[model samples]
Target: MTVRDLSALFLDSTDRPLPRAARELASAGVPVFPVAPRDKVPLIRHGRGFRDATTNLAQVDTWWRRFPQANIGVPTGAASGLVVVDVDVHGTNGYDALNRADRAGLIAGWEFLVRSPTGGLHLYYPAEPGAEQRSWQAGNAGIDFRGDGGYIVAPPSLRVIDGETVPYRITELATEPARPLDAGRLRGFLDPPRPPRRLPTQMRGQGRTGPMKLANWLGGESTDRNRKLFWASCVLAEEGVPYRDALEAMLTVEQRDFGSREIARTVASGYKRIHGDPRLAGKNSASGAGTARAVVDAAPEDRLASARGL
Candidate 1:
């Protein structure tokens, strides 16, 4: 049968996957952008951040033509008015957590879902204006959210999880994302009841040292910069550093060699890995935890599929 035919599986490298996916998402009024093809790295991040996203048919056409191999990106929060519940399939944790959430009526309002190449799931919801949402490790295992300041890789892009390349496809397709889950209820169900750990001193918007500190800690090696920055950003996220604060901090060192685009990409990836097993923290570090995660998280995305992979 044809690629568009019934039961066609995997959208990897289908003819014009980027343009095709972009056209569909844009037609539904979803703001869209291009990402590094075969990789989830963002292509345009300046000026408006993901806020620069657009549904302009011509802009969409121009982007795909310019970066034919680029992946499709859907800015998670106000850009597209979306909030996604990311249920990871690295293990059964996401599944179990989702089940628990389901029983508690947490996921009852979900309107659209996508099955990720890695076997994870993406539950999409519309966003509410001025929503106080933030991207974080959900209270549940292997569960996370793409809310304000967050984004999700859209379909027809190649996702290389571990060494296996697959497509981000709809399990049951929809023309557009559905109405959002009840934000208040979602928070109540997903957030910890106790007071969260204090924000890092620099994250309070008080210190310029935060950036230098992370840069210093990460060292100055281009080869290791991406990986180090990836894990360091994760630690910053785990420590509850504000996104802008963390971005500034990471950017200080990122100036040496890595591009802002790389920083942006690693930060997002690091944010996602923060939810994994707590025990795996120091799998490769002599110093333990963060160091180890840095090495692994920095490695090629495919290498991340190993038992010690981030």
Candidate 2:
């Protein structure tokens, strides 16, 4: 179905009874599934969440009959030919970040505006044909993109908040032409990439000399910071630096930017990469007294891909 048709369907059925609204949506060829009453959790038994959504009227009728008060869940992205940019209000005030994005022209093109039960906003857009837009969350900005592999509770779906049941409501419908949101562009604006920090020429091929110097340099770096930390940790490992010392150095430099767990994981990955498995070096084992060198030849992107959550 066209985005216009979907928008009209939602606008018309905003106040309709939940079961009838769900059936109407299915009849219009929009796949839907039952969610728990007053909750967003899918109610289908042994179902793989939104993947089980269907436009089959018989199935739709059967589901609603079985769970009369169930909320309607719509799978976003190509499954329903729509995507959503969700602006959350809870922690960071997403409207502020959204306003910044709007000023940059990155948040226009929405066909429908929905008011979530939590006082957040869901701006719906048509899925760009043949392009897969994956879902992502920018927690610091309190905004999320619901694209592929995501689902949204449709209008009239009720949520229980503070002992009260409130409905997700259709707030506005576009009168002018609508377009698809460039999710990538919006993400880039929200969390712009920082330029890579280059290792000094003197440090290159020095074969593990001046491990403290490496730590000092890393302290000032903030771009591809995790991968750089991994590189430094590998160098330290090759020099037979103890695991404890390496952890101390990485934590000292990156504690402000990364969690202790992430720092520890990256350090462990680097050491393991060089040693087959990580080992704590003996205190008497010479730091910067390099053994046979293991090559660190992977490019930055490859290295980043290999590291988890970098």
Candidate 3:
């Protein structure tokens, strides 16, 4: 029901087995359900995954009796008054991201830290009452936030990792008073929104080829969009187009799965590779198209790499 109660449960259940730990948690008003042995999938067939969680002791007993090795699962968010920030280490470097977020104060106020079987971390925090913090993933950062509509495998539960059974163990508890996490703020920090791009100019007098034509070509790309955009921006940079003008033109491209931030970043990378800086461009190259052609001809390898979206 409160942080204090769960804290006691974590401490006392460190040596207890899974079935007893599940009972003690339910007795403390923390609803729980049975997950498969050494796995996260719920054992309950024909039932909603986390929605079937209940504080009923009889049901908990029956389920565990049927599958003695079942792991303990607790629903996160308001259902159990808890949420978790899962820092993974398998593919992406989540600890690096977590450390950066911690330094920024975006991932502070965690009540407890559980070391996952795969050497990842589970930072537990109290969920803010009367609010819904839905689950989300920052896969690139190797971090996942589990809130409403999500369930976590509780401690003392075993997981088969790399052909070995490993336990989810509590490694630390907060010394000072713990506070609820701001899920929305953390999400925004992880994936910040890019500002609106400057609109393309309607004038066609400056460059030999108009920005609108490039925009039309970019908009029609159905496959390998990022590579195409980067190569096109590199070509434009070679032509002495100003970085601002080139960005404006690319902003006019309407394509799915390509956000403004990504488009802007790719274009900037291309421009930087060419001009050695993103802010400066070849505004004087209007009549210097031959100069760009000469540069490309001299460095065929670089142009080839750019084409492969390097």
What are the lDDT scores of the predictions, listed in order? 0.59, 0.73, 0.72
- Candidate 1 stretches with Cα past 4 Å from truth are 1-16, 45-49, 129-132, 173-179, 195-310
Q: Write the per-residue lDDT of candidate 1 for residues 118-208, one digit (tens) a residue.
A: 7677766666555445566664477888877778887667877788888776554333223345443444345433322543344455553
- Over 132-249, each residue of candidate 3 has an lDDT whose tens digit, in order, gives 6777787888889999889899888999988999888766666545667767556545644332232235423445655556777778768756656766776677778888898898
Alpha carbon lDDT of residue 295, candidate 2? 8
Give lDDT tens digits, candidate 2, residues 91-174. Answer: 887777876666555666677667787877788889987666778888889899999899999977899888888878766556
Residue 166 in candidate 1 has what lDDT? 83
> What lDDT does model 2 reach?
0.73
Model 2 residue 112 lDDT score: 61
Q: Report the Cα lDDT for residue 253, model 1.
A: 64
* Predicted structure 1: lDDT: 0.59
Rank order by lDDT, top first?
2, 3, 1
- Model 3 misplaced stretches (Cα beyond 4 Å): 194-310
Stretches of candidate 2 off by over 4 Å are: 194-310
